[model samples]
Target chain A: MKIKREYMELGALATLALVLLVAFPLLLGGFYLNLAGKYLSFAFVAIGIVLTWGYGGILSLGQGIFFGLGGYALAMFLKIEASGSNLPDFMIWSGIKVMPAWWAPFSNIYITLAAIVLIPATMAFVFSYLVFKKRVSGVYFAIVTLALALTFTVLLVGQQSYTGGENGITNFTTFLGYDIYSHASTYAIYYTEIVLLLFVAMGSTAVIRSRLGNVVIAIRDREDRVRFSGYNTAAIKAFIFMLGALFASIGGAFFTIQAGLISPTVVGVTSSIEMVVYAAVGGRLSVPGAVLGALVVGFLQFYLSNNFPHIWLFFLGALFILVVTAMPNGLMGLLDRFALSRE
Target chain B: MELMQGQQGVIFDGANVPAARRGHCELSIRNLSVSFDGFKAVDDLSLHIAQDELRVIIGPNGAGKTTLLDMICGKTRPMAGQIFLNDLNLTNLSDFNIVRAGVGRKFQNPSVYEDLSVAENLEISIPRGRGALASLFFRRTKVVKEEIRDMARIVFLDDLLDRRAGHLSHGQKQWLEIGMLLMQAPKLLLLDEPVAGMSPREREQTAELLKVLSVGRSVVVIEHDMDFVRSIAHTVTVLHQGRLLVEGSADEVQADPRVIDVYLGH
Candidate 1:
């Protein structure tokens, strides 16, 4: 009977894939399709949050740090490709006569792709391992991650010459000598993003269904019991945290690709908290729900900000409060309740 | 005694023998001491538990019964002492490593994973795939499934296998935790007040369960209920002010003046 529910979840994922891959492309215009691609990028972070916060009981308020790391890693490669033989335009303007040594590795596409995942994963592992090993968790861990996001933003903004500062790395005309801005390329990129998103969703589902996922859930509820059960609770938590970072980084890379830029504003503390909101509104336990959450919330944010720019923040705040108080499980929880009552 | 039938391995029959005379004890604690700030929670305590013996430790609230279990299970580091489980020194090891070394502890509270099903709780407690990577790739083999089912039956939870642990009655939750520990197949089991919240009938059933469980392994329990202790304990150790007050048959300990003065009389 429990297995049946899992299959039903997989069916929902299939339905979601059909909508994203076929229905959206058929129904929406080119502009809306591109916008949908951007929302899907944020969905990656929301899915990662589901694993870390919803299941692992490790609420990281600093996910933007990993996301930024991934975005910046890919953006550096894109910027290098756009600049061709000269220093990136921002570096030239900032009076930097030569490319920084750190940026040299990202100039290679393979190295950049590896760094997009590895850098964030390594950082998250080391940080989480050190903290969790000390048995620091709950609100204290959350605060530490929040501080990390703040510190990361300050560091990026402070180092203007190398990082492109607050304005961030932008104005990418080409990716590997191909005009990325062309209509055909844009559609291609959108389709590629959809495929990658579905692949990641499947991977996340597999992890959630595995024994490791059970351990993660167990740790979330009774960490001491898990430790007494002959498992190193800290190591398990750190591994899951690293996995979440890996997902966020991939999303960050995708975000940079779709949005055409990477900025401190997009990867700062506020943005990290907003990413958590996407998970919360989607139903943090459901992978497909997270994707739906990102799309629905992302579209709402766009519409509200455009129509009622001054009150959008208040509206978002109200929505979050409403979800937490009335529907702790988010949209998926609501849907499940409806389904259960119907049955 | 009939519960001892069909048991394998060495079953130590000399429950009354002195610690120095025993050839090999399953658990040996020597001069164990721990202090929080300047207060000694457990002070200069030494004890021995023989294989297949069911020993119950009874004490007043502050007499360090739970603290002794804590130190033995590696939750609390002793300021001074050595804890030996067979040949291995468990004093300095981490809690999980101690568990891996074949010691299972049930806390005072029924600390089973409430969100998980009864079967999953048992499955997670199985000895294999304890490492992070190992757990990620761990499969539910037929042997593992049988083990879980057998353990559920032992704990009287076979019918509730798919039920969420949170929904179980308090006594059922306690049994689930015991079943979880059994899944580890530990050489030594430390239970802190196993029947703390159980009803009269549940307590009697637990007593029977413990007798059957003690056939092949050592069991140390901390309990407040004297009747429950009398029913299951092969030997009772009375602790007073972080020191051993008495060690004898349940009736002898109940009759001891020091044990009564410090614990039961109050």
Candidate 2:
């Protein structure tokens, strides 16, 4: 634990939340527990976004690719298991008797887990290596990462025969013999997600506090100076990009279990953009800020759509701008200021 | 110290750059040119630096002095021509590689990591490099910590060791930057406006520091401070309109008619 003293404060908070999460499922009942499970995954996604945008000073707009990859890993295995005939139902329904070679890896949980972690990290690596190595930063970085997300969404949308496509792969829930819809199962998943979220939050805190973190902030403040100081800036950026992707994929994997499905709609261009929005709305620096931002945004969407579903995205856009234009550092900054003044 | 052991009453003013081996090739530039878009920032310029000579490049504004330093340090590549350092051709060398090859640079701005404590900043500077992770595990094994402290004492910043670098006064920040560069232990130090905004007393002390620094290493300094340049430069290379107009000893160059005209007219 002392190997990383950087994230100690955030670790404390995360530990507190984790205890609450583990206990809440049993105390609060199944429906609410599943909703809380959804929150942890969302928290992971926000932490991932923060690593790039908040710390590395990278403008990544395509976190959805990793999220989608994680979701697809679980979805593919679940579907394959459900079919019980080697090929998932979609491939058979589309007149393709053979499963794609790419889908073969998800049959084993180890491979699926590796895919959950590595695929997104790899995507981040390749994309960020190409971009940051060329010194593409600022809005240029934003555009390229967003473009990647857009491409993934388009690919998923068109691949209806293999994937579920626009309608998405949803319903028929169970993971490794546990019923996804079961009350205990929901609590189990929620607890697992909370643990993952705690780690991401703690990991990011350590990263920001480490010497590597100093280099990150230095790169943010003065890239030319860091370069002159003999750091391979592109390599550092790649490292952070991969780290962010890992967090995003973890969130995506948990997202699949909570929602019990995977599809293009959930992990699309807009979803990628929404990741940035959460970071921006979360104050972009603190781990707690990201978690808070995700929770607030998630609740806002859930409630607004529950009332007037048609204007939900519009409300989202407006809220984002309002928060950005006014608060700048998100709700935590606001809360901190309020508490300070009162004291 | 041994160089002067053979001679009696040798003056030590940091003006001696280490002598190069007869044919080692320290740095060579040929028809180097760099442009931004259509504008010629530095055009058709060429220069050579001896193995360990501390040479001062003095030029007026827009003389491409900074740009020239940039080329030497691999911060910018020439649109035309090649830059060579020792055995290696450096035109294609990346920023970090160039530094790794011992071509370190200090910018005019004091760009130290602001939030880090002075000791922490110094701790990071020891150049354990690329994988500082392993270096951290073996921090005490390295001599960098002691060296950093020794350097702080040399720079007269030993007392400010625990203070954050950002809290330092302007001149103190500068000494910290120089200390950071010293931590690199570079072969050829490329300095751009090292004493631009210092107080008079600070400027005098900096001139003294530069003099001490020139004894054993090669330094390519871009400076507009004529008096400071006069005090420290072994040989002054005057630049005008992105060209090397003349090169000579400080006193000899100051008396040159063209040098006077360019310095006055600009």
Query: Taking the tens digit of each residue's C-alpha lDDT, what string does model 2 give over A33-133?
Result: 67656765777878877777787788778888888888888888777666666566666677887778988777788888888887888878877878788
Runs of candidate 2 with Cα error greater than 4 angstroms are A1-8, A11-19, A310-315, A338-343, B1-25, B30-46, B79-81, B114-124, B131-150, B156-169, B264-266
Candidate 1's displacement at residue B196, Å, is 2.3
Q: For model 1, what is the error of residue B58's alpha carbon versus the real structure, in angstroms, after optimal superposition? A: 1.0
For candidate 2, lDDT tens digit of each residue in B138-210?
3443455556666677566889887878899878888888877766766677887888788988889888877
What TM-score does each of the candidates earn? 0.94, 0.88
Clash pairs, model 1 backbone: none
lDDT of 2 at A227: 78
Error of 1 at B223 (Å): 1.9
